[model samples]
Target: MFTGLIENLGVIDSFESDRFTLSVLNTSTTSILSTASVGDSIAVDGVCLTVESFTDNSFTVTVSPETLQRTTLSEKIKTTNYVNLESSLCVGSKLGGHFVTGHVDGIGSLVNYISTNKAWEMTFAAPSSKIQEWSNFIEPYLITKGSIAVNGISLTIAECDVSGNWFKVSVIPHTYAYTNLHYLRPGDLVNIEGDILGKYVEKFLSSTLKSTKDRQSNINSDFLAEQGYQ
Candidate 1:
């Protein structure tokens, strides 16, 4: 699990087939490499990748086929050289952001971005080519004002359409300058993870409703009246 708070930025040193090597950009501060060890999990662009090997400044991970299909990691290798990185949450660490599983649901793209006086309002939408995947995995959980992890950066939905086709987030200057969001452009792909709580609630409610519909109740109004004095 993670808090979706980005710790450092990493440059993609090399990506070939399933193996990826990323060099930490800022090692002076608390970085993923500082405590990284083989078999440790790290959030790379919101995807939880296991550390297969590491050095003082760089680490390597192998991407599974499922992760590649669900996230933008493969696309990122071609389009962007930098990736947002965050270490897994420790037991006693402060929960600065929302609970992020680092399990990306699907990929979204930057629709547009505008600079406001205080923040940068960035709009994102599901790519037309991957509309089905977006609808199935991402669209259902896009609640206005709800938490979401975009490229591993935790953010709230500033606004969203009723149909859930698109959503926007207000990024403060600090986050914009510190993370990889500053490098994004229109049509750039990003990994997206919806609030895990919302997904759990949906699953529970759906299952409960389904079970209620399938079960035959023994007590109707007639039966209740017969059993009770009232």
Candidate 2:
């Protein structure tokens, strides 16, 4: 698990098929590699990746086909070399941000961005070509004022439509300057992970409703006997 608080920015050094190497740019106060070790899980652009090997400034991880299909890593590597990095949460570490699983649901693209006096308001939505995928995996969980992890940066939904077609986040100056969000342009792809708590609640509610409806529809003497009702 992660807190969606970006620790460092990394530059994609090389990507050969599945092997990926990232050079950590320790621009932040904390360094991801300082306490990292082989097999450690790191959130790379909101995708949980394992450290296969490491050095003082760089580390390698293998990207599986599923990760590639579900995230923007492949497109990000081609369009930009920068990515947000965050190490997995330690037991006693302060929970600075919302709970982030580092499991990207699907890819979204920057719809637009505007600079406000105090923050940068950025809007994101499903790419036109992949709206179905976004609807299935992402849209259901988006709620106004809810927490979301975009490219592994914890942010709250400043605004969103009831349909969940798009959402906007207000990024403060510190986050804009520190993370890879500064490099994004309109239509740039980003990895998106909805709040884990919301997903669990949705699952529980769905299952409960389904079971209730099934029991109601199957109401009969035989069903009562099976359920051990006298």
Candidate 3:
């Protein structure tokens, strides 16, 4: 799990068919290398990647075909790019952001950006059909005032409508200056991991309801009494 709060912006030193290499390219970055170890989970642009090895200021992880199909990792490698990085959340740590699983639900592209007196507003255009179709899997967790992780950054959903199947987020100057969001441009793809709590709640409700419906007798007091219901 993660808080969607980016700890550092790492640069892609190199990428291959299965292996990826990243290094601390930002001098102002404060993420500690000593605190990391092999086998630990890290969020690389919202996609959970396990650290396979480390040397110097760089680390490596192998990407699976499924992850490549679901995230911007492949696109980034083809374009030779930098990526946002965050370590996993630990107990007793400050919850700076919303709960993020580092699991990309879908890929979205930057549509536009504008500067506002309060904050920078950005819109991302994704496959409307997919987001709406997956609403059953994601909507219950999304409250009007709840949170979501966009490219590993915790952001609030200013507005979400079914008609456009799109959402918008506002970024303060600090987030814009400290993260890779500033690098986003029209048509640039990003990895999106919806709030984790919502996913679990959706699953639990669906399972319980489905099971109760399937076992119709399990719902009646008479049937429950046969099983020692009090």
The candidate scoring highest on lDDT is 2
Each prediction's number of clashing residue pairs:
0, 0, 0
- lDDT per residue (tens digit) for residues 49-149 in model 3: 99999875789999999998778888888765668888888899999898888888877777789999979988765655456534543444545556878
Residue-level lDDT tens digits of model 2 in 153-224: 999998999899999999999999999999999988989999999999999999999998777666788999
Between candidates 1 and 2, name the one with more favorable TM-score. Answer: 2
List TM-score per model, in order: 0.92, 0.93, 0.84
Badly placed stretches (over 4 Å) of model 2 are 217-230
Worst 10 residues of 2 by lDDT: 72-81
Clashing pairs in 3: none
Write the number of the candidate with greater lDDT, choosing between 1 and 3. Answer: 1
Model 1 scores worst on lDDT over the 10 consecutive residues at 26-35
lDDT of 1 by residue, 1-230 (tens): 99988999987888898999889998237777888889999999999999999998899999999998888887767754689999999999999999999889998999999999999999999998889988999999999999999999999999999999999999999899988999999998889999999999999999999999999988788897998847
